[model samples]
Target chain A: MATRVSPAAEDREQEGDIVERCRGFMCPPVTDINVLQGSKEEMRTRMEMLIMETQAEFCRALQEVDGGTFKVDRWDRKEGGGGISCVMQDGKVFEKAGVNVSVVFGHLTEEAAKQMRSRGKVLKGKDGKLPFCAMGVSSVIHPKNPHIPTVHFNYRYFEIEEEDGAKQWWFGGGTDLTPVYVNKEDAFQFHNTLKEACDKHHSQYYPDFKKWCDRYFYIRHRGETRGIGGIFFDDLDSPSQEEAFSFVKSCAGTVVPCYLPIVYKHLNDSFTDEEKDWQQVRRGRYVEFNLVYDRGVKFGLATPGSRIESILMSLPLTARWEYMHEPAKGSLEAEMLEVLRNPKEWV
Target chain B: MATRVSPAAEDREQEGDIVERCRGFMCPPVTDINVLQGSKEEMRTRMEMLIMETQAEFCRALQEVDGGTFKVDRWDRKEGGGGISCVMQDGKVFEKAGVNVSVVFGHLTEEAAKQMRSRGKVLKGKDGKLPFCAMGVSSVIHPKNPHIPTVHFNYRYFEIEEEDGAKQWWFGGGTDLTPVYVNKEDAFQFHNTLKEACDKHHSQYYPDFKKWCDRYFYIRHRGETRGIGGIFFDDLDSPSQEEAFSFVKSCAGTVVPCYLPIVYKHLNDSFTDEEKDWQQVRRGRYVEFNLVYDRGVKFGLATPGSRIESILMSLPLTARWEYMHEPAKGSLEAEMLEVLRNPKEWV
Candidate 1:
């Protein structure tokens, strides 16, 4: 340039524009501002920006309902990249709500690769390590009211560069509902909203992904599903990247409509101490499923420089484990247990 | 006039004597009374009797301290043997206490054999299956008082028969403590009790097994040991089977002495709500360790026909998880966290 401007100076000048555009985000993008601005067309940048937007929107929606602001922690990994974790604890409605978005870059580990293989991903890495980038938004909202079912969702994008400089990418995620007490109307509304989102992309997505969700969230030792199914899919390298991204966008965008109406309906409903106890006990099963069998949790725990606080933010604020706890016959709790034992099609 | 007693009648005659001898047990042994009477000399029978006795004694000690009696469930496994689960929940002093004894006989799955091999056991099976017999006494006591700490212990013996008609066997177990508040005296007392028991068998037993315990109970993601170190050993087929049994007995016998005094000392200590919250948070860590890293728990969950309630009875009655819950600088909780992060020699 005639003025001889340094690249660093140029980056600094653009950072202000980046920050302004990212104002609604829970925090700044995990990637460097200059990198984000320069690589706006890249999928990694697009995914990062998407997750940041999703996290902010989700947090704002929760705040409006709970009258509690999220306490945000912007954390960096020693290896590479970082994340923003926003938690609303002990709110008027929500007991513990966490929304997290992370953009991570590192060498893919053998363990992580093996896990991906089990999920049917194919990759050829040099010396069992591949340069990779992962970005995702994950959330779990545990409400104080027993009648308001717990909801969980995660959407992620992954890319790996092989020794030959070949880029391989995929997308994965799901949305599910867990209720302390079974409500037909709530289940219908939740599943119907998810089904509608899926139908926008493909007719088969709802049925196929709902079945996948049931199988994925099973508590095998207890012979029960984690909750009534919604939709789950992984390794979505479909007809086109744009189409898959559009599908995921539709699913993520429906979170508020899918969950908030159930919350609004049950927010004022009265519940007994026994119902609360049942919720705690159900939370115990949640802990068991996540810790014992969840692939994402195992991968996070195994990964070097992974943020555990964000990974384990999926757990409920409080849980209970009682020896041989069982619901009495013909009780509402028992009815819910029956549905958990046998998942039903909602839509 | 010899009465020409049939085998069934003879078993009934011996069952009377068996019931009389088992009067003090929480429940009758898992093995059939007749099989037990006939195979009194067999290692499987002896181990079953030993664990039943240990379970009964441990339950009684806990009851004496908490003024709560255990509710016992004697259950049978359709495939092979059965178990006795004794739980004292919502006690005055103890929040939850469980003592379980099981004598299981089955064709060991490849998974179980793989776990055993990881523990350095040399196992040769036919078609990845071996007929195995296992009997164990396991207990976890969560005291209500934050200062009292939680204690867990298990003692077990395993015997496997190879396809070549050769028998292989070993003994494994440990005792450990987790405290919400750090007390040097309590740690010292607990470790010294275990060290004394270990020294009775071998001079190096305490140091070696204590290190093993620290390694075994580690919560890797948190970079902390589950508790202060104690004696932990597996595959203890030492100079002789009798010697190993004696060593295991000594370690198991010290449980009451090692933990009860700590309970009594802190039983009356007044704790604020914050302290109670801290205890709940620590229990969350305990849950993390048990669910994520405990080999026994993994084996139990993976094994078919395993009793889920009995296996998970090691969990606390109530536990709490909070996002980024860090103890204040130089606080008591921080002090405990430091020791957990860097395990200290107490004996």
Candidate 2:
């Protein structure tokens, strides 16, 4: 049984306080329509710079909470000039985590574009070929402390061409968290923050996208979920490309206010070693569900350009099995098992 | 992946030089078939005496090897009616081991008999409501030194009524072994020893029964036989009950001579800690395959009268999953994996 947690109600509660009342906040700052639809070189430069800025924004938020610096391990600029991979590890709050955001825009190979067109997952041009480009910002945060709860968020835009190398564009991104222990208020605040960001774009956005997020991370074999969800939307098209790009940015921008505070409030002394062990066992189940049943894992493994390490980074350190074990009666472990067996709508 | 190692063959090789083979010394003396088919009460008393004698024989063998006496912590007989359970712990040659062999024969409940009749797993009476008694002698030897290899063998006999009780008859027993390591010559010897015993009855007995033993202990999930096969046959009815009884005795008499010397020779000073650890891990896998998938486990769990611990006694100590691990490039682990992926005729 999977229960979808919607971010809409949470967003409605947060917008008045967070977005409207916050100081030093910039709203509807500028409108640069042509900045999104100019020459190919300009579009590539704009997307690349935006990816770096988004990554920098994420790093800055982590530094603020933990007061720990991060070392940029790798930043590989694309060979044909499209994207960058910025990786980091060993933070005070995060043992080993990667915050990667990519923006790669290029003309798609005919074969590749053709497959995408068949799925109706991409746009195509006249003359029977697609002039394509794509941009994506994906990040995964695996925390050292099980209590802090790991989170993931990604925002992307795709475009396919016209005969003159022109293209149509769209936007997509959402964020979600996976907590070992439920913190009702923390979850509420996290979803609420994203909901407010989404509400500004469309009232229906938060609920629709939150359901999408929940459905996206389900591990079917065990009949559970990867995490409590946030919001997700894809293949978003707008007659106004600038509006779509701004909406995607707003979704990405909500991650800091939503997730960072929750981590700060919970990362310290919130759990015991026993809970940690329970978390590991749960993680082992997660690994099994992912490797054996997850569609994302299948898709990533099948995709030619995937990095194995990055794909498997979510696995935990240790797990155990004692023959015919049932969690001790009246224990927190039992409580967790009950919750897992019968999922509940937390938001 | 589980591999079969025959302790039977090793025993056969050592049996050649023995002064008094078990079959030659014992079976000839117990020639009064009338004495064996006494009243139920008389038979129970006699079987208890046999149990004590066999337990004594096992203890003596252990003492001879260790040069010191081993103590049974407790020996308890069943209150209603049955043999004793002689348990020992932390002994020189054995640890956490029980050399228990029970011979309890009785009338089955009408329901149980009917169920048995429907399943056709075992023999049933002509009336369809089985009126019979069964006596099974089984032992599981889990030596402290995994290098010594765990061994299991069982022999039994059953006699049931004809429709009007006018033509009641009897059948015999067979024994087999399970070892942790591969001992090719030991396996060959084991099979040959059983063959010699069967030769006293008929030539076809060895080959036919040997295949039965091989098929019986096979763990389907593992796609491999449990150990080097021994001889197995049930209800060996020929023209007369005397013929069936003789065949049964021939098979039962093979066990001690076929297995004792092999155990004595390989009990100590032949294995390393690494090998022991490997055995433990293999046992862990055995435990998994059993608990999760084995038919016996299912039957035991489902059976209303089953003793859970006794049923679960087959589990081993440890197991592991090293992340995304494929065995080394060219190693026994790889070979085992290959065999597990594809089963074959080792014999």
Candidate 3:
């Protein structure tokens, strides 16, 4: 019933390839494990730097593609941190897009620390201050083309101060694709790119985290995954701090390669009105998952000085929810739901 | 920006009023307190009859007004209950609307009983099966005309068995109005109609439950009430069951008088594309409150064998979310938000 489209329409596929914005800045070569040696604070600082660079580069590249203007809002948190949110709306290629980078440093309140312990993290400073710093790059893109899947990427580094001056640190995040229609080659490309990034860090990266993503993004009520599974790792303090930081660096660095190709693939493809309506419906599911079930979003909403706009910028510009809607049994839409109900091993 | 709308739309103002569907049934007159006598099962059966009648009459009248055919789906729950769902979509006046009646009776597990106790219910069954039965009629109307406010009504009866085989009985429900564009005449009519119903039962009914509705429907994160509240009461097992049942019946019976005149006033009123867009945006807030904050929605989702479609029929067919969306200064949209942030005393 809400199958209404507005005028002022533009398609990314109708547009040509984006002009590269990276003129002279060379890529930071992967730091060797020995060279990456650092204390928790040092690692946090490095992660913060990398995340900011990623946000700038990604937004610039996106701005080139959609020819959309990005509004950059930088604000400080009273609780000892700040963030920069770059958002684009009504772009030629993208409908709504956000790339946010935040680095927060603060001690957890007693109740919060206790909740964290209940969630299974061993805190070294039980009575003392549970000093923590979290840094991350998070992005969500809702493309103009329903055929072009909505994609999300987040990679973060976390440090918890321990008793006796020791510290606990780890990295977490993943990238997932939510398509209005399941395009096989696009899905494969998405997973393969992320798989390559993961394999560069560890052999177990793709398989373990891929399964974790399947579990992590599951929409229990709907009995389906949010999208095709991607790598998701949390509390990943392994081999050494250097190795972990390097791995997160690799994951963070590979975001564009992992997502852009698929964007290009469907950029110009024409879609029927039905497909667009279906896309809106799928987006309704996305909103449901983020608001009702996503822990990261829950934490953000609960955290003091939380930026509501950046937190909810993940929602699509428009969505629909029909009562008890179901696609005809053998339709392409039905096929898409089938795949989502049971995610595929794309790589 | 989602501030866009399509051209192919009609308004309800152009249509004539619905032929009254109350012709076939006679209202049950209130019983005097001294003469009232009924067992728990007898009272529950009477409530069920009244709710079922309400659902049928409401849907029949709506069908005449909207010129939209209703699809009736009746199904039974695995948990010793069943429901009837009447849905109309893409109507002449309503984009989507639903009227549903459910009668459910089942035994609560120990954990569920504990949760009830935590909510301030003094359940007698500490280690035994808690017997419970609930009957209710709930309806949500999402009109096509942006000027026509969305309305929701619910009245329910609950009966719980104590360890000593004694029954605890009560009635709870209210009707609320959510307008995309606030109209003073409409707000006055809505409150006055509901006030008349409340005053028939008790002098204090309007004030106490109006404040409660204001508190209950608040969207905390957005700092706004969900709508201009009507009335809401729970666990009202006092002043005799006869008075309570008669009060809820009076409330339910007055739904048409409360909403029909407003719908008629705005039905054919022309609106700009911007107004329709704002309506969609406000509906997004409605969706947020129901999904994130409504305890009834949470209960519906958590309860075993809950009819998902009926539970979610309250959602609008379409919604839009724009990042950091603020209405233009001194605009009608802005004024609506101002009132929502500080709910008014409308009479």
Task: Report the Cα RMSD per candidate.
Answer: 8.5, 14.3, 10.6
Model 2 Cα shift for residue B321 (angstroms) = 13
Model 2, which residues run further than 4 Å from truth? Answer: A1-45, A64-69, A73-90, A105-115, A122-131, A162-166, A289-297, A313-330, A334-347, B1-347
Model 3 regions lying over 4 Å from their true place: A1-41, A124-128, B1-41
TM-score of chain B of each: 0.92, 0.68, 0.87
Residues A151-243 of candidate 1 have per-residue lDDT tens digits of 999999999998788999989998999999889999999999998777766777888899999999999999999999789999998757767
Winner on DockQ (1 vs 3): 1
Residue A9 of candidate 2: its Cα lDDT? 34
> What's the true lDDT of residue B23 in model 2?
36
- Residue B166 in candidate 2 has what lDDT? 49
**Candidate 1 error regions (>4 Å):** A1-20, A125-129, B1-20, B118-120, B124-129
Model 1 chain B poorest 10 in a row by lDDT = B4-13
Interface RMSD, candidates in the order listed: 0.5, 8.3, 1.1
The alpha-carbon lDDT assigned to residue B90 of candidate 2 equals 48
Each candidate structure's TM-score, on Cα atoms with residue i matched to residue i, is 0.93, 0.47, 0.88
Question: Which one wins on lDDT?
Answer: 1
- A201-233, model 3: which lDDT tens digit per residue? 666788889999999988777888888877888
